[model samples]
Target: MEQAESLALPALLAARAARNGDAVLFSDRKASWSGAQALEIAARRAGALAAHGVRRGDRVALLCTNRSEFMEIVLGCGWLGAVVVPINTASRGMQLEHILRNSGARLMVAETHLVGAVHAIDAQTHALESIWLIESGEGGETHNRSGAAAAGASVAGTPAAGAPAMREIAVWPLPPLGEPLAAPCIGDGDALAILYTSGTSGLSKGVICPHAQFYWWARLTAGHLGVVPGDVLYTCLPLFHTNALNAFFQALVSDAQLVADRRFSASGFFASLIETRATVTYVLGAMVPILLGRCASAQEQAHRVRIALAPGVPGHFQQEFTERSGIALLDGYGSTETNFVLGGGVADQRAGYMGKLVPGFDARVVDDNDREVPDGEAGELILRADTPFAFANGYFGMPEKTVEAWRNLWFHTGDRVVREASGYYRFVDRLKDAIRRRGENISSYEVEQVLLSHPAVETAAVYAVKSEFAEDEVMAALVLREGAALDALALIRYCEPRLPYFAVPRYLDFVADLPRTENGKIQKYKLRETGITTTAWDLETSGYRLRRT
Candidate 1:
């Protein structure tokens, strides 16, 4: 395996395309493009962007779905030495405005249906210079003139008939320009991406992932996942996420074919797997439960999938999934701030551990003071990679956040964990999500894991809420399996013998569904918001009480 420093992403991709021209590289539900064809598309898109005055280091905001166009824009930006800012589809007026303004994007490429929203926000933003609709039509042709005005300008009356509107630019579909613009002239230290955090903490911050950081992650993940030429890497996670882009790089660097989807679909996942002949896929924990809920068939077991890199897998379902699907599922632990810090490799596939830290990376459990905690004790998981390669440059445009996260020269992950005797790390919970009651630290992840083991429980999120006693208390929001129902008392009884008195949730709220991030991680922050004031259930006297089975 080649080291991260020795490889440039674009060069590696070009080399692969040259060798495997005819291999299928990307596929959606409608069409598939060969490696050679995909590269050509990227080249053309890059040329088109350049033609539109997009230069090296320019920020291009991509607000589109999970399609070939998204990949083209990303790769094309790489080829042009431009930074790609992928906006979440879920973002609306203000959120979209914040990202576009903060990124200092010169141009935006959005889908036709979303043009109205963009136009609504574009009037208040000054940094956006142009807008291109991916699905343009006669109505969408006037997008530029459709806006109220530039920032601080007022719109008085309706637009005059036949007045000139925003120029509708054609989608440039050509091969990359001459010499691929010298690899965008970036060093290992240059910022490559400005990925906005999902804003679970109330304010979204752009994480500055530099070239060397991304390269390091891509190289290690590709090697760890055993990506190779002619293999089809399936990606259904949104390209806006580090997971998708990281997997994209893994496939690109290894000369492997890529099959992308607009989004992960429980109904369409197996079909897409067979359609694309995908050899490897990255699955989130939320996706696993969704797939498990679907009825199993022999067809699902017949797909070409060999490996499933599913992160955040709870303890009980790990074995069940492997037994049923005949696919090896490896759970890893990582965050957007830290790319692929710890993962189970081909050599080691433990049941409930996130494997040991990778070479050149150091992991330790630390206390609030940043002192190393003794092994086997749960504490904050702090990790740092060797030198400047594996670590990110900093949070983009936020000096305070960057300094806070990188305190003492180590990135504080905010996740709590305990190191086992076998060198494996067991995830306990997030430090903020941990429950503190009467001076005892309770892991929400541990409680949720135990709750998931209950045959009736489909999903669970445990968090802390202010109690009437003026301290925090353990509260649980649960989703029961289809056709299964247990009252609140029944659940408490079920957990009585399984958990310690302090760990058992005093309050329980049953919901039809839980909110999730685009990558399928449970939005515990949302649950915490709704769960804090919820008086739906009473432990001492409630209609929904669980009885011993």
Candidate 2:
């Protein structure tokens, strides 16, 4: 019985509470639990993180949003062996003081309106040491970034003024569900959760993971989206990333029933996937063109959703979003330091590749001298796995960026793909988001899928700027469709016939959004540090001339 990949989240919640202790599993818009009430709320949230002085490999952090007390502090920091760290509630200042000082964590639960972005950081730079909140307005108190409540605070212990340089941190409140604590001696390669990376070219590393890398990312993404047992997986993407925290470990090792939501609402996404009867769901890649630029409703083919996984979608919006939402999106490839290594299952999917290469992992693609690279050419993918710690056990306190991204024994994945001798793969771009111009090379994901197949484009991005012959130029940042107008020279003559006249967009802008990263990605290094902005638009100073057709 100890084989769920060497069990870890406190023996995988005591073997799913000894085989489905009253089934259910988890839900969100407030409640619902089961598997013996999620193993008795992971032992009363591991006895309220050991009465606040958290222990095992410590590091707590969790800046809330997406509730059920953020999955009971990630199952009470994996039933008290401790490591959680979730963050990205749209972080803040110096990337929330470099993730609370590179996760030295020291107890941070958050969400009484995000503890005023942790009392505006700088409490001697970080390693927090207090804050619990989660109560939401007045009773949980701690407000201050002008949303009121700081005069001799009203709940817990307080001491939280403007956490300046050397001290005063405290702030309490979120405690109850205390005495239950049992499951301790953990393993399955320990470290369960550190996450972090949407650094989008800098700072955010963290990774670590282990606990058999989220039990092989919920047994290879619930066996590539055919997640079974009582099905229902939904996810409005943002349990602080790793694709909605591995869709809550693929509905806890597939006894399936997750529902999460606390975000992504393209007009309440098909009435919350028809009131969560969600037969496996989850999205990303500009949420499939923002639910295919909204408007077609009758809740877009109503619900009982069938399939979704959807990693970076856009192979012509995956068959017009599975023919306008009878679900089925698929596509793959993974990364919070890998697992679900590539994908398959909706009868081994293909349209827009990323699959083939899963059997206990080991990939290649190479070329910036790490060799390999031949099949269909593009390079840099790497990988390795064969299971052990499954994949990520490095980059926490960044030991030289985890030996420069796991040096030779592979794991690089700075991404760039193309394998194809029918073994699939495809995805070309993000080898630091490639875009050379004039000397060609572009693919900012194929010019943001030809500026998201135009029709008043609602969310493009496509980057790279520097050119004055110094190289890179493309640029884009769009977002139109709400009373849509579009004309940055008619979106560069609709990307000069679907791109390649030097990948069209010689700078555009139009934004009302797109600088994402709290798990909706697209932070193209803050639009390459807000580069050509004198109200953008340029195209070689408006003279426009692309000929090569």
Candidate 3:
């Protein structure tokens, strides 16, 4: 199947399905879609979306978990040339509302369980034109017309259509499998999707990814990761993120069967891998220690997994992990803003290095002035690919922010690192106050601001410290107000309901004073160096757990 004329994702999938109609394309517990079956579902979904007034360039928000519907919508949106906005299912009412409003989503497809959360924001958001609930049952409660129509009414003594009525649209079944749809008139510059960054770094910004960007990234990833057609690639990462989506696309491009999990579970990981006979899988450094800490069994080493693609693995644990698990751990470095700048495939395995830069991309270690630093000198990592089509279009709705990242003709990755003479890059730390935990980015400034909201908290500084397992873990250093004696449990309780789980500081260090620079800025580097000191209270270990609070 030639991709020259049909470079769009939908067209590519369609062409592939036509070539391999009966091949198993995707397998999940809820459903298994063959190549032809998936293509038909995508076509029908495209028709349904188009019938609902979704057109080219229109933003359609998908707030569903990892399931068959998610894949169908992703492929279908490509056919209609509409930009898909994949919302994080973990986001609360306010976060969801911000994304919907910022994206100016004309349509929102939410799951049955999330209907309540969607309705909570329905009254406040004016941009949403329609809300379609997935998996609605026959005897399900009907949409409240009063509540739905009331959204159009003004709360400020004026009338404004806040959101359209939550309607139970008919489920469109998959159309008869046919030859792949002919190539649509699309270009490398067309906006394909907007993946919002995890709000760990302040408010999340929607990263604009085009069809060409995804296609090239997928190609490079397949080459770098050594993905093959017969390989059964298993993915548990949320599809909303670039890593998961890239994994899925790379598998598809290689004609490999994808074994998907609704959500990642440390306990069920090995079982799923063995059951699916997964030959390859992607993981974050945080997951590595968690898996290793779990009760080791013969079955863990018995799995057919040949490669574990991990990022940000600590230098010391690399050898121990490989020896214990009998599976090679291939570590690489990249971010949502830029895809696959450097990686080591199955063939290249260095102990501590994050492999050499891949073809089509240029990498350099630069100092504070953006000038190239000598080899082995630590500096900010900046990457540029010759193919502009491979890079992200820009951050959606934020021109200044987009320009800031893509300035000087190089995509500035806010990571600090050093490159060795062997071309392998070593990650030092982040220049931006962003923390990477469990493959998720968390902003130190954002968490600090949230912690400071407590009445007893005079000031707070958040930073990443080395966890016992291997990767960085969130740790907070806080100073209580004068005459106030708030303990760690109270502060943990306060943050439990306010922030996402990853953003919640795992270790709390209560201090009388916080280290700061002369300019009055908190010196997170110094705090990180000090590590976890305050053992006055261990909240996470104190059995103070809340179920989805």
Candidate 4:
């Protein structure tokens, strides 16, 4: 499949299915799809979407959890030349509304458990005319427990003629298999997905990824993992993010099967791995430590997994996990815009060093003016791909952001790194004031926006405080309204439903006021430097527990 990178998703699937029709392709608790079966399902779904008036270039947003059906719908959209917008399951309130409006999605496919979150979306913000609710369980809110089916369901305030239609479909429903439709017009450059990523500007920006982006993402990462036919690529990471999508690409391109689970559970991870007999997977950020903290399970050693594409593992933990599990932890560095741009083979991988730049891209550490920094000096890492559309096309609906990011002919990563004389690059810090908690990128601006929405809050400055393990813990310094009587716990409870679990501030301080610059902008550097004072409200100690769905 040398021309695989140039083939659109539909063409890629056809090629694979023809060569290995009966091969097992995708799996979940519900069922497994074969190579031929996957293509048939995708085609029927494409037909279903067409019947729903989803046409070329139309955007279909998916808010379902980690299930094979998500991939099925994505592939269907790909075949129809429709853009697939994956919404973060953790997002609710304004965050959910923003993505739908920003992407201008005509239809949404969300699971039953997520109906409450969808209820929070502002119906007036966009021209969304339809919602295809997928039943998650027998007793979910949107599920019709009376064993009923319907053509469509009426939504409140929807126009009788043109307003969005809301309909419920079964969880992981399989449309009738039929002849796959041909989309000769859909090419590699056609838009495939709009992955929402946190920006330095607080509000999340949707990164437009073309079909070619995912194709190469799979081929390259699959090569790095040494994937072969019959290999089982496993990932419990949510499909909303690029990491798992890349893993999905690996399976599609390399003729490997994919075992996608519902979500990551640190306690049951090893057991899951053993059950899947996975050969390769991904472990990001604190997951490595969390897995290590578990009691030594026989299942850990029983799994056939050989390598884990750990992008952000600390050096000491990398060594310990490798030694203990007898599985190699390969470290690399990348972001949503660009897939992995740097890495090393397991034979030569270095702890904390992000290895040499991957082929098909040019990378440099540069100063503010875009001048290349001297080796061994800390500076912003910028990358330019040799192949066209290898990185994200740009930020959706934000040409200014796209232009600003691609300035000076390089995709500015806003990450601090040091290129040593030995030619290995080590991550230093995030130049942008973003926080990485667990594996999620928390925009300080977004978090602060939520905090400011509270009635008692007057001024809020949210910043990242270094976590004891690694990455960051979100901290907020707030100045309450005059005579306002509110506690940190109360404000947090207020933000519980409004913000994602990861975005909620773990440490809160109600200061007299915030430090500002002459331009009247809050100086977050000063707040971060203030560190955690004794008065800071510790959410963990305050008995606040977050339920991760």
Candidate 5:
């Protein structure tokens, strides 16, 4: 345990399996697994990938929710020294296609419910060779139309030149075990995964996370959360994000139990905590405030959860949540591209301020020209690591972007923060066109691009409106073509299939023209300040439901 400095993921997993092979590592409502059992099972999956021609450094796309198989697939890919590309399951149409093509994923493993989205994709464009389906255990027919098949049916890949003979193989309905193969020599700096984060400039960029970065994330966070052996780390956040993945590794570092579900349910949050007897967990964005706002239940003060790692909870809500739920909330600051950079415990944390910069990171707040702003003045937050591999290597496959981001020897966060004279950083606003709804980071640029693709829209300006929850809601103001008329519901229907549910504009305004600067730049800040106009189309009140089909 003392020799943790040089260890990477595979080395860590191998050590744990040897140390406590039969010990319980996962204990959720659905199933349970021992460390040894998980290792052996995931090893077979590694062989399966190798058998299918996947090799070290190969990209394997994963479209999964919060299933145990998600972790297994990560482990399997790590065993083969392959880089896993964990895409957001809510991603549909071009958003999904962009990640597929950008990552150049050779193979993809998706849940049965999500396979349709992938099935509709033009595989050749993404260079996808094959796909394996994970049966959802919910009784339903596979989406393949060419033949009637059972759970393990094989469907042809979308026809295109240079595309592999694509087969939708249902190879994961049940866990398969095979002989464990020798793992390749992988180092701490080796790339573990490529996670696509919403770019402020509107394009999604892949953040390359190295294994050592993950190791430090786990170690540092475990120390912060006071995780101990036999403690239960309950999480329901999707595994695609760095937040949940950090908690995942924290459980491993502490040799604690993990209870995870596919997603968060505000109503069921307390009951699940009691069910798993969770000691520590995570609550991001709207979760803590929403839970505090929920109708009081008999189970509110009855759960075993003692501490919750709340990244950005409002101070008032943090106090209220503790008084109501008997759970303490701790605030911290980090992003997909960085680990826990600044944070403190409940006692040290002040309301409305991000804690001081943590060890292993050098932090600064700088103006546009990379000059450090005076304390108490708003500026962009930037960071440099004191330890190697503590942050992402770069945005994957984006050399110019990488150079731009690391310019002036610091990673520009594009987040406006003010370093108070007291040294606590206060988040002011985002300096980019992005929206955070619930737990999802949505690119306003991407949403605008989708809206412009519609025949009726001549120009679109997308921005964030304040949500009842702590996060923001997406709003779009559109300039319709001359004599063009698009119904709100019709536009909603168009977006349902193309954009993720969160990215779909909840409020739309058809305007004659958007406010522009002298340089003809659409002044989104003006629209954002104006917020939902009286004449704007309100999708929620209009009874327009998201259609999955």
Candidate 6:
């Protein structure tokens, strides 16, 4: 397979179009597009964005779910030299406001169903000047916002009474395609997207990814998965995530086809794979166990899927999953802020270990003071890229965080790992106060803040506990105020609107006091050690369900 002249999105699209214009490149529930058609769609989307005052270097926020428009907006922004900020569809309350404010996005394109989130955000709190709402199954016309009403575009209803009157920002149907804009001279280092990642001790930070990081991500990932031309690559992960986004690049760089579903459905997973003729697929560690738990069916063995980029799978389940489904799971390590830095081909992986460091990237197991630790000793895994623009530039609009994470000339992963004498790395635990549940990164500090907001709660300590699915579960230890009474269910109810459904603590413990240090700082490690005591309130057994909107 040949590579593009450069790693820029425009160059990649142009080269792919030139090589095989008629070959299908992308498909979702909305539509499918070939290489040339995809480029043309991107050009037209760029024209529409430019007509709405989105210029080069300006940020455009996307709050839609998995759809062709998601890819269109992303590719359009890249082609036009603008930056796209893809917000998590589940984002709400303080997190949503912070992203909109921090990104400084003047124009937002969101699904109509999720427009309530925008209405909930006070216009004064965000930089949005306009919102283009996309209705279900309908891709808006190619006209400007001014002409949208006349073109029969549906206008969004006014905000509900008592809600902030967001009259300052205009609401229009998804704009029509404008005149096709030509690609500019984009470089490998140009910002492609800003993906927000949860911070350990603070709010989430936007990771400024350049063109080359994804270029290397796709090239290396495709090689590791052994993707060949004409192979069908399918993923059910959300498009806002780096994994699914990088899958698109894998198809673009190699002459393969990409099939992205709206979301992962455990029941229909194998059916969809068979229908899409997928030869390669992706799954999270949590997903593997769910699939294995289901009763054996013919569909599991009927698919042609030979390999899956399955990360975080329990070591013991690896062989069981392959034996049941005939698809080998390849365990690897990568993050939104980094590329495919570790992992290898299917034939070269240890059961539970993250594969050895990939070539072109440097990895070190270091102590807390940044000193290198000997093999078999657990330490923070820090990494550096050998190639230029192969990792994220840094956190956008936050220089202090950028320096802190990228200090000492290495990007700190904040993950604890131990390297074996043979060079394989075993995962230990997270050094940062972040929790991973259902593939979503939850900030423990943010959860603690929410718990503390309740008037009855005087102190709160939020941390992670092991879930049955081999992922982290949010657990909170709370201290009530004097003469105050609050049940765990009531606190969860208070948190439902204030936090994402997943961030709400599944296990809550009401204590007289929390463990603290001499300086009065909370010692979270001690709390993590005594996870889910018998007296703790368990939401799973409480019969109350969280509404995942």
Q: What is the full ranking by lDDT, best candidate first?
A: 6, 4, 5, 2, 3, 1
lDDT of model 4 at residue 324? 74
TM-score of each predicted structure versus truth? 0.72, 0.30, 0.87, 0.93, 0.94, 0.94
Give candidate 4 regions above 4 Å deviation: 1-5, 138-151, 157-179
Model 3: per-residue lDDT, tens digit, 52-115? Answer: 7778899988877778778878887877788999987666544566677789986777665544
Per-residue accuracy of model 5 over 1-549 as CA lDDT, tens digit each: 133745577777777788777667775567788777667756777887787788999999998878777887888888788999999988987798889888988778887777677766665557676667777653235444423234555454355566666544333343364468677788888899999989675589999999888888888778777888888889998789998887877776678878887778888888888888888988886888788777888798888888988887877787788888888777878887888888866676787887888877888999899999999899999999877787899988788998998998799988999998877889989998888887888898889889999999999998999877888888899999999999888988888888988789999999999999999999888998899899898888887587533
**How many clashes (backbone N, Cα, C below 3 Å) per candidate?**
15, 2, 4, 3, 2, 5
Error of 3 at 13 (Å): 1.2
- Per-residue lDDT of 1-549 in model 2, one digit per residue for the tens? 124645588777777778777888888867888888888888898898988779889989888878788888889888888899887665544556777888889778877766665665466766676777777543344345455334334222223365433566666677788999987788888897897764234556788897878877887788878788888888887787677777787777777778797877778888988987787788766667766877787877878888888775657778888888888888778777878888878888878787888888889998888999789999988898876888888888879878887799787877779898988888877667666443233457656766777888878887787753325677888888889787788778766644436567778888788878788977788788778888888878788787542
Question: Judged by lDDT relative to the true structure, which candidate is superior, 4 or 5?
Answer: 4
lDDT of 1 by residue, 30-75 (tens): 6677767767766667777887798888888887777767777887
- How would you encode candidate 4's per-residue C-alpha lDDT over 407-468 as one tens digit per residue? 98799998999999988999998888888887888888888888888888999988889876
Candidate lDDT values, in order: 0.70, 0.76, 0.73, 0.82, 0.81, 0.88
Q: Which pairs clash in model 2? A: 34-37, 430-433
User: In terms of TM-score, how similar is model 5 to the real structure?
Assistant: 0.94
Per-residue lDDT of model 6, residues 333-402, tens digit only: 9999998888999888999899999988899999989999999999999999988899999999999999
lDDT of prediction 1 = 0.70
User: Which of candidates 2 and 3 reaches a greater TM-score?
Assistant: 3
Lowest summed lDDT across 10 adjacent residues in model 3 is found at 149-158
